[model samples]
Target: MNKWQKIIGVVVILALIVANVWAVMDYIHLADTAGAWSAEITQKSFFDCIFSFRQHFWFYTFLSIIDLVIIIVLFICLWRKGGKQ
Candidate 1:
């Protein structure tokens, strides 16, 4: 990948991480307010909680998935070029 592609890829990765972190935090806050799911959430795995947000946050989930695919494609491209700068 060229310099700009590398920058874009990093930006995408950072955005994905930030969004997921925020989502998790927001979910935790919601659970606290619910007074019921607070205990149930502990029983569930971390990924399970994230997946539960899919329907509620479809756009975010969709964008994250697309960013992941882009990252994978970028990795493949780098591999094909034998890691040459």
Candidate 2:
């Protein structure tokens, strides 16, 4: 892959991993602290923020997969271009 595409792919993967992890953490925290969750909903606590973010878990995962596909395509394109040269 080109340097830029590779960098983007890495960044995307990291972001997705972080998001998924946060989703898991938020899910667990919500389950653990039942009453506190509503307070968080009112005040917008960290766990609440994460809870909102969890909504995009599937979306981010899809984007991460797309990023991987792009990286693969980039490598193939670069390899073909190099071969022609």
lDDT per model vs. reference: 0.68, 0.67
| Candidate 1 lDDT, 1-85, residue by residue in tens | 4899779868877977887787777666655544435455453564565566556467657767877887789789879888675
**In angstroms, how far off is 50's CA in candidate 1?**
14
Give the residue spans of candidate 2 off by over 4 A.
Answer: 35-85
Say which candidate scores most in lDDT: 1
Best by TM-score: 1
Q: Count clashing residue pairs per candidate.
A: 0, 0
Clashes of 1: 0
Instruction: Give the per-residue lDDT digits (tens) of candidate 2, residues 1-85.
Output: 5899789878977976786677668656655554453544454465575576565656657766766886898799888999986
